[model samples]
Target: MAVTSNKQGAAMQLCMALPENFRRQDFLAFHRRDADQLSEHVTEDSLLKGVVWQGQPACLSLFFTERNVSVTLDADTAWSADGQRTLEAWVGHMLGLTQPVAHFEQRFAADPVVGSLLQRQAGLRVPQSASAFEAVAWAIIGQQISVSVAIAVRRKLIQHASLLHASGLYCHPDAQTVAGMDEEQLKALGFSRSKAVALLGVARNEELVALLAQPVATAEQAEAVSSRLLAVKGIGPWTVSYALLRGFGWLDGSLHGDVAVRRNLQQLLQRPEKLSDKETAEWLRAFSPWRALMAAHLWAQQSSAGY
Candidate 1:
């Protein structure tokens, strides 16, 4: 990818070329729903408010075209050599730019269901959270709840705990911020007692966050991280798997107990009832190393059909 950096007075802008098959609309679909909480959508640009290393607040407005993505930041500090590298890494992670899309497409070419889904929604990517801590917190908050309600509660938590950037955008709260929040305040914002305690438990344990933040380039590495996360209270298989997929970008990960996955599977397989855990595991294994991307495709399929 080609990167160009330019400074216009106080504003810093960087442009990077996307992959050959990158589709901006497909990437935006995954993030558009959370616009109110972590980002703002204006026309074709998605404005991301985030904090860099050492808790430096930064705002990035991403504009996408067929071949490239342009990021305009409000602060000049983020344009420095080190800052630019950090920003590029973060953007690549968020957009799943490093994923082996061609390999997955080749693997799914003969599969009936995933192949059909891929044909319908080409160049779809699994969008990730800005931070692993945020992914874990959202996983806990979403347990046994609908997506809409989880988003509502998350927005409330952000409003209460996050700081506003100088650019007038709200940055997502770090683990430290959530750890310091009162349980009563979180409960008032619609967090269950268990979820509140779980969030705090994750936040207070710096080691857990560090472990979750580790790079998982192989199945064994991903499983090690999953096992460590499972040791945390209130974190289950579903949560760990989901976190591995969304937080660590583990391609082999699958949300085995996900309701949406089960529902989508039932609909796709023409089953009268929800698939059992064993059955879900068997079906998900069909995609093997690309199960996470398969899950994203299922979600995109359902969303497009207005399910």
Candidate 2:
């Protein structure tokens, strides 16, 4: 919780700290997937654009140090205490500030592959999207498609549907905005009809939104939420698992049938073939409650050395 304030007339600047073991470079690297998409919104200096609080948009620059992360805001912005709190919560969710890594460290202390990864990437946290809606939207958009294609489609959707902030940044569209989009509009953006329908369905489901809005504090609670999400028309086990990990910040589950996870596991074990889904699950169970973190570490294997 690194929050500082300075006032000059009507202008204010605020700063916040990165949590323990958190590395700014690692975070930025993880989000830097494509130059044409959301990753572009995160700049080299770690200045993130289109941060919306209470429906107002602002640009935030994050400066990293050995001990803390400092946040600087636009000079004209004056955030209230409540607004600041909201911003803090949003940053926490995005950076995984509240996630504990000690359990994982202890659990993997004697293991080989995961232990090495845990040691190598001590402060690496599983970053989440700004909101559950954004996470679910991304899941639906990414279903059965290559990551690059999904990002392209998502960028198109954002270009068309997102709100442009006065700061020249675009805020991701909410459920209502996406739900209002017609099938042809989505198809033009490369969304399959089924995916478009699922996106619209999720956006229109108030009950689902309300359910995700509640705090998920335990594995059981997260599982229940996953069950409800799976009940939706196009939401599958993989999507629900992904939403739980990335949207709800649950550390209890992994991307159960993800090919990347299997590939990573196979590579870690020095196996000639990818692990079967059952084998992946059985092996991943060793990570237990922190399997999501394990998945993040596995994902990091293909990423830059920042981890």
TM-score of each: 0.90, 0.88
lDDT of 1 by residue, 73-187 (tens): 6663534657666667777887789888778887787777667767777767677777787778878888899888988888888788757677666666787777788889999
Residue 295 of model 2 has an lDDT of 81
lDDT of each: 0.74, 0.72
Write down the lDDT that model 1 would get: 0.74
| Candidate with maximal TM-score | 1
- Which number leads on lDDT? 1
User: What C-alpha RMSD separates each model from the true structure?
Assistant: 2.5, 2.9
Candidate 1 local Cα displacement, residue 148, angstroms: 1.1
Error of 2 at 108 (Å): 1.1
Per residue, candidate 2 scores C-alpha lDDT tens digits across 5-116 of: 6654433445667665676666776566557535235655564655444444545556566666665554345557665566567667777888887767776777866678
Native-to-model Cα distance after best TM-score fit, residue 116 in candidate 2, in Å: 1.9
Write down the TM-score for model 2: 0.88
